[model samples]
Target: MKNWIINQSLDHPGRTVLISLILTFILGSGLRFFKVEDDMMKLLPQNMESRKTWDKVKEEFGNTEMIFIAFGKSGESIYEQTTLTSLWDFTAALEAIPDVEEVISMASMNRMDSEDGFLEINELLPNRELNVIQLEEIKTYLDNHPNVKNRVIGQHGDFLNVIVHPIDGAPNDILAGKLLDEADIYLGAYETHFGGAPYLTGVISELIRNDVMMLVRAGMVVMVLILLLNLRSVPAVGMVLSVIFLSLFAMTGSMGWIRGLTGSDKFLFTLMNTSMPIILLTIANSDGVHVLAKFFKKFRQTGDKREAVQKTMDALMLPIFLTSLTTAIAFLSLIFAPIEVMTGYGVSIAIGITWAWILSSLMLPSLIMMKSWNISSRALTSTSILERFANTIGKVVLQAPRKVLMSGLTIVVVGLAGIFWLNVEVNIQSFFKKGTKIRESLEF
Candidate 1:
């Protein structure tokens, strides 16, 4: 099979490259359907006891998700007339937003009082503009009713909290955007912050999108620099990067395509998938580097590019295939994990590794055959610093096998001991730095 592929690629390099590009384009187009799954509960196994309970609660009652907004000016009491008026307007604006089922704030509360042996209930802030006496009466009522006061008022009267409940099935990202926009318009002069599970989930979705793009770009730049230093050829680095990117597109695009075809949320990208691109990039680069290194040596010996490609594939095909297979199988083990997200992560990454292997074996050889090389004498004869470093380690192992074994065992033992003291945190807020606005809002 390897020989057939190698011969076909060598026999018609242009046809091979064209076919690969066409396949890649068709798969890459599926990227248009990609989406991020931000609901943390969706990542858990559906059949788990806690997950089942949560689902049951939501089905029986209603949307339990809450978004908390806190707003006030520093050194200003929320009981002031202007502040109360602004709060009233803000609450009304929030209630007007679509999908918002309820908005709870002091402005929306009802006051109960006894008069002439009868109990009566009235709007807490009946009018948007409250005089000083009316504001004082509301403050006194809050002082008597600590539960209501604590829920709506912040510590030391520095701020007021508004709690919003969205209808079931409402999109969190859309609701969060609307809520923030209203806050900016209504409470623009005051200090406003937001925090809640729903809000954090939306924030996480954005962060994941940003991180995926940032990390992949950074990884590619670093890989290109490393490849240039080692391969010392612009064309060689380009060939390797092409394979890497195609494999990435195939993997990510397959997720979108699968979701579209199956109409299932199982394949949606999760926080766990943020590392997929970098992983595939490293593996694909490894295969390409091996092929190029071996081909360069063979070409130097035979002075024939075609012969070098054949000899390189003949020597490397089995070894590279086995390595990729073993790595994919290792990741495939995650299918047995209890978390649904881990299963998707495992399967998607395995697909990526397989794509990398295919491209490395087929498209890389075709690319090599098509590109004319001006291999420097130094590149053909001189060993790179990496090779020298590997050689030095090999000599140490050969000269002192017992010492190397003891060192390896000692390090493993230390790592095992450290596991006892490890602390695990699942809070999304913990992912951000202390000074970040999201982190501060969460803390507040």
Candidate 2:
């Protein structure tokens, strides 16, 4: 089979390249027809008891988790009478924000003023003339109470968060940073202390976004460094990156197609976050690297660029095929997971591994055959590592064939037995990392 690939590539490398490209454009484009759902909840199994309970609870109360906000002045600014007066004026303006159900402030509380005495509680005010002394007295009261001194204002995001409940729950989203921005502008504008739901939401939100961005960027940087360490040439690295992007493009396009077909919600984006991409890259690129490395090795061996591709394809084809099959089967096994999101992730990546396998095998060889691949001298310096590893594996398998088989079988049986005996408990809460706002929000 390896000899056949070598011979065929030596004869018509261009044919290989052209046919693969056509396939990529044709069937790859057909993925445009698939429809998938993105709603985060849809990813969870409908059969679960907790999910059922969660859905039931959300239906009645309309959602009490308000978008919180808080603000603090820089100096003794709130101590001044002018600042206190401005806060009263700004509180009146905040009441006009759209969709506000209610606004509570010290000044807005109803005043039962009498000539001899006064009492107060928050209710609609009765129209009456107030003397300057009376308004000043209210200002003094607000200055002393830290609740008002720590102003609570609802801004746009809180308004949105308050409004956009899923009739169940939203995808864990960042409202804290957005709340902080609004609090900063509103509090700074009014020259008053502000503290409430929005401020709290913003602090929690920024922490989440920072962690997500950090994890993703860190993964990319690490992968790039690995590639550079393996193969120093920019073009080689670029080719590898191209394959990665190509797989991603195909996956995203297929996801979009699924969305169109299913009329699914938007939270699917949350499910794909990072783990799925890593798995996709690991499986797909592992095959690609095997084929590419062998191709280069053979090319150096035969001193014929065209023959090198065929030789590489011949040598790497079996391992590549086996790895793809095993990876696909492993992913397909995840259909057994009771979680819907896990099911979606498994299905998406399983399909992606297949596409990556096909494209990487057919297109990469063709691309290499079509163009001259000149590598830098430094990174490829250690084929001995791959070679020695392969050699060691070969020797061990050859030396203890029966022992290896018995050992492997014994281990598998023991592992299976242990797994059967183990008791496990799991839930959606496990998916979120510790110290996350989503958990905090859920608890609240």
Candidate 3:
């Protein structure tokens, strides 16, 4: 198999390159149809009872997701003329947005007054103003109605809240954007803050988007720096980075294809893109580095790129294959985690790892065969700090085998003893770095 792949790729580098490009283009086109799902419940498995029940409820009642907006003023009662006017206008503006099923606020609340033979429903502040007597009466009534008081009407009438319930299939980000845009127009007189499921989803989705771009770029920069420092060859670094880049493209594009064909949920798209690239890059580069080192060693000895790559493949295929398999299995274990998001993450990441392995195996070798890729032989011969440290350990192990063995046993025992101190706690908020808006909002 090794000899066949080498011959096939080396014998027709142009054809190999053309085929690879065509396949990549076909797979990558799937990205045009990719959808991003921001709902946390969508991450749960479809067969889960909780998910089924939630879906049923949503279908029956529409999306009961509320967008809560709070209004506050400094050193003034919410019943004051300015605050009440702003609140009334804000409530009216929010009610006009499409898909907003209902808006509940102090301005919109119904006050029920029971008479001798009938009941009357009237707006709590019908005129948005009150005389002293009317204020006392309304306050008394609000104090008796615990459900409405303090929730929409503040205890001291110094704050108010508007709850907008959206209809089913409402676009969360667009709705949130509209609400904020309207708030900027209508609630400029008061201090305003937004809280609710829709707002949280919007905020989280934005954070994930920003994190994907930042984290992937940062990971690539760090990977490149490390590769350059260790390999000390521009061609070597380029070959490794190319494999990583192609692997990421293939993994993401294949996910798009899967989603397009099956109409799968987009739960894994952003989350996986945010995390899997860094992990796949590292894993892809590890195998590439090992293969490159072997190839370089052979080439330094014999000065033949094709022969060196072939010999390296023959020597390292089994070991690299086993290493990738075991690493993939370790990631696949997340499928058993209780959370549905973990299961999605596990499947997506495992697929990415497999893709990375395939790309590295085929493309990396093919890339090497396309050129001479000569490098200074002194790279391997130099005694860097790492080499000196490794030599010292070898000397100690050889000269004092019994002592080294005892020390190793002691270290293992100590490590095992410390294992009991480990604790299992999953704080999802901690996943976001401090000083981020999402983390701050969650903490708040």
Highest TM-score against the true fold, candidate: 1
Model 1 lDDT-worst window of ten: 375-384
Ranking by lDDT: 1, 3, 2
Write model 3 residue lDDT over 1-444, tens digit each, in one string: 766766665677667766766776676677776565567676667789988998899888878788888768755776566677788788889888886888988778889989897999988887755666766676778888888787796555666878899877888877888888998998877767677878777666766777778888898898888767666678888888776777667666766776778675642564544676677778888878877767767777777777777788888877888888888889779868765556545665666677666666677777778866545545444433544576798999999999989998999999999989997867767767897655654564
lDDT of 2 by residue, 369-407 (tens): 766655435434446454567789889999999998999
Score residue 328 of candidate 3 by CA lDDT.
80
User: Tens-digit lDDT track for model 1 on 21-125?
Assistant: 898778777788778988988888888999999999999997888999999987788888878888999999988988899999988889899999999999988
Candidates in order have lDDT scores of: 0.87, 0.55, 0.73
| Error in Å for residue 374 of model 1 | 1.1
Error of 2 at 106 (Å): 4.8
Cα displacement (angstroms), candidate 2, residue 79, comes to: 8.9
Per-candidate TM-scores read 0.92, 0.64, 0.82
lDDT of 1: 0.87
CA lDDT of 335 in candidate 2? 63
Give the least accurate 10-residue stretch of model 3, judged by summed lDDT: 378-387
